[model samples]
Target: MKIQLASSEADIERCYPIVARWREIEKRSQFVRQIQEQQKFGYYFVYLEDDRIEAIAGFHIIQTLARGRVLYLDDWIGETSEYTSGYSRILFDWLMDYAREHSCQSLRLNSSVRNIQAHQFYFKNKMKIEAFQFSISV
Candidate 1:
């Protein structure tokens, strides 16, 4: 019922498996290091209720010429058992409020083309599919 920054090892540990499952990360230590390094550019937060973590969200606030200030979410992984409705909405609402408070003009994220569940949630929250991203690995 509360969202808190996942900074300490203990905090990260609680949500590691959920994130690992979604991202296919193989090592806990590697995830820790990645999160640490990413903190310079973004933040990871955990949703908790009764001392149990139910979701993890990774995001960054950036200034863009196209969108002005935007809240870009890199990940929003929730426990499968609670991912369908209430819990996901709680975190989503919190992020929306966070974006507004930070003076962001938009909240955006890119989900894999295969993640139907996430797309459903996004659409339900009134987000639109505005563009297709093109990229190639170097």
Candidate 2:
């Protein structure tokens, strides 16, 4: 399995549905624009198994006074199939290496409280819960 940047329309078409399983986007045209917007702040990557996409994630590297250099993952969703476990491990291990190589002090991400599968994965992977994520619509 390989993790590659998803930058083309075809790539987005293949991966967006998987992400949509977790976050609702009202329309495909809207999703395309959002992908462009996201590229300004983060990156979208897809995990591939024999030329087919199996997982997708968005992540950004930023410097903050509180955390120094950190890797912030915005989205991570895998095909809810039998191969999910292997795909997840490949993606996460890659991210771990990326964070370390970039000199990031931490890898942080926010998951909806109801996402039990992700929460459990975080726990098993030894990530600590430091604070709640709060947000409001503009």
Candidate 3:
């Protein structure tokens, strides 16, 4: 297995399919392109095994009034076979290391309310349920 921060147009291509697969709830090519343009703000890390892309994790360092400097995980998805099988841990550890290197104070993510399995996974990983996130569609 190999993990590396995606850094090129090709890398963005590698990430698109994974994002599309996991986030079929929405489709926004322009948003994806915006994310690609802002690679300096965060990274799309790809996990490759046997020359196949198995997972992708997107993370960013953000400054918040409440959280201060923190690492915000935007999206994380692994092939179903890889879930609960240590691949998530590996990807998280890598993100944590990257956060630490950048002096981030904490790591946070908003798991969709419907993703019960993801909530369990986060709990198992020792992440605390911090607060409720509310959104209103504009």
Candidate with best lDDT: 1
Candidate 3 Cα misplacement greater than 4 A, ranges: 25-34, 40-50
Model 2 residue 124 lDDT?
Answer: 78
Model 1 residue 103 distance off true place after TM-score fit, in angstroms: 0.3
Task: Quantify all predictions' global Cα lDDT against the true fold.
Answer: 0.80, 0.77, 0.74
Write the number of the candidate with greater TM-score, choosing between 2 and 3: 2
User: What C-alpha lDDT does candidate 2 achieve relative to the native structure?
Assistant: 0.77
Candidate 3 residue lDDT tens string, 1-138 = 788777776665666665677665254565467666667555555544436677787777789898899988887888765558677778888888888998999999988899888888788878998799999999
lDDT tens readout by residue for model 1, 1-138: 578888787777667777888787899888887887888666656555445667878888999898899989988877765558478888888898999999999999997899887788889889999889889999
* Candidate 1 residue pairs in clash (backbone atoms < 3 Å): none
Clashes of each: 0, 0, 0
TM-score of 1: 0.90
TM-score of each: 0.90, 0.85, 0.83
TM-score of 2: 0.85
lDDT by residue for model 2 over 1-138, one digit each (tens)?
567777887777677666677678877777777887888766656445546667877888999998899989987878775234677777888888889998999999997888777777788789889999888999
lDDT of 3: 0.74
What's the lDDT for residue 128 in model 2?
83
